[model samples]
Target: MSGIPGANRQAPKPDAEGAGSAALGPRPATLARYLTIYAALWKNSVTREMMFKGNFLLWIVVELLWFALQLSFIGVIYLHTNRIGTWTQWQVVLLIGASHFIQQIYQAFFLINCTNLSELVRNGKLDFLLLLPVNTRFVVSLRQVDLGAFLNAATAIAVMAYAARQLHLVLTAGHVLTFLALCLVGVWIHYSLMFLLATTSFWTIRAQGIVWGYYNLFQIARLPDEAFRGVFRAVFTFALPMLLVSNVPVRVLADKLDSSRLPLLLVGMGVACGLVSEWVWRLSLRHYTSASS
Candidate 1:
């Protein structure tokens, strides 16, 4: 394993100075170290975002406009039909809000960082990431944050809340908590899939096209799962499992859990994808040849 070019390597010892002292402290427990690193990265990301006020505001405006357009489209569809599949106007809006929330959360935290893996591999920047003391995957996935996307996430939450109120869906504390948990599972599924795609750069040297294609496929999840049938439904539900991301959470919120097994199925799929992605990443690492070589 150690012989592999990009295999896990011990972090170099810090110099006697203060810089290394902070990172080299008697290695903290794994979870503690990971949390500490994530916190620091999040702080740095917020600080950096603040330094570029114009860009930050621009992205926020663009995201708002995009979400508004989605809502307008939904309104237009409702004008023609009372419901989409089994979902009513407000219910479908809830699903759309859930989708945006999960997508933005993933984008804010993991997408930017993971997408950079290809660039890192192509330009040899991955050398530094591989040498970090922490788990390489953790470092690569959580190293950056998008503050603007975080704001959009908040907007999505507000949309969900408003939609729920409009629908008169009585949401208890348990319902809210469960919905949030399932949303996190949805984000995990997305992260697992996208991370897997990004790792392909290790072999292809350029996998952006594949990444974009995956994103396009993910758009299907924004619609109600019941809108598809037969083979198309099976492909997304079992193979890609994108539909389950937003659909399951929205169903749970709407108290439409007649399919008692759906939650377990969604969770099982997420765990499966996560494990497979991790395996693929390790395999990619073993196959990696540094750019300088």
Candidate 2:
């Protein structure tokens, strides 16, 4: 008799064994591994988008047309009045451009990822992600990129540049850097809130409608914060903070910040939203029942 159990049994084939071993290899450290994985994901996204050239081109055209329509609306509004609650025509244009920039960047990088969480939960595809040898949250939140949305984001930059010229706003290195930083903070705020909405799918099984309804609040970001008042203003400003996303950054760039504390307040709101979203995500995961169960 063999000394070891199964010593005389036929060995598994080398090809199968090697493949299994490779799949089970030790996972790398978080930051480096995450960077590598995200790069790969972005490359795969670009390749997949390129495979459907017509669809990609059509989406780009649609986004550009929508942007033009917004500009036209702004022009019509300005034709009637010199200013809308302290925002001149060009300032409102800048605000809308900033709003578009933040929204497009969120859509390009995080919107699909957040929205897909619901589908994965509904169909039990999340099990595949959970079984992977990497962080599930990172993988789930950044699996794809929308290249057409990124192209639209570039158009937003052009709009902002034109608005700045119309307002004769001098752009300094510091101002540009501050604007970009605030824009990213705005994007992060949107991502956190949207992800929180999607995370509810663990309980609801389908949260796409709720996720999109939350997205509609972003339209209010394009308007001047000063235009709102009383109860309605308090709800969005303090509770939701949707009004602050584009408004603060535009105020920073336009030298229209009413208080020195507005930027600080916006940053605090973004941090709070991110922390709350992460907590909700962890809690929601605890409630998830795998499809097999």
Task: State residue 213's C-alpha deviation in candidate 1, in Å.
Answer: 2.0
Per-residue error (Å), model 2, residue 106: 0.7
Candidate 2 Cα misplacement greater than 4 A, ranges: 1-29
Q: What would the TM-scores of all predictions be?
A: 0.89, 0.89
Q: On residues 1-93, what C-alpha lDDT tens digit does candidate 1 reach at each position?
A: 211111233223211242255445554443455567778998999899999999999989998998888888999999999988788999888
Regions more than 4 Å wrong, model 1 = 1-28
- Report the Cα lDDT for candidate 1: 0.82
lDDT of 2 by residue, 183-251 (tens): 988898888889989999988976999998986798888889999999989988777888899999999
Q: Count the backbone clashes (under 3 Å) in each candidate.
A: 0, 0
Where does candidate 1 have its weakest 10-residue lDDT segment? 1-10
lDDT at position 246, candidate 1: 92
The whole-model lDDT of each prediction reads 0.82, 0.82
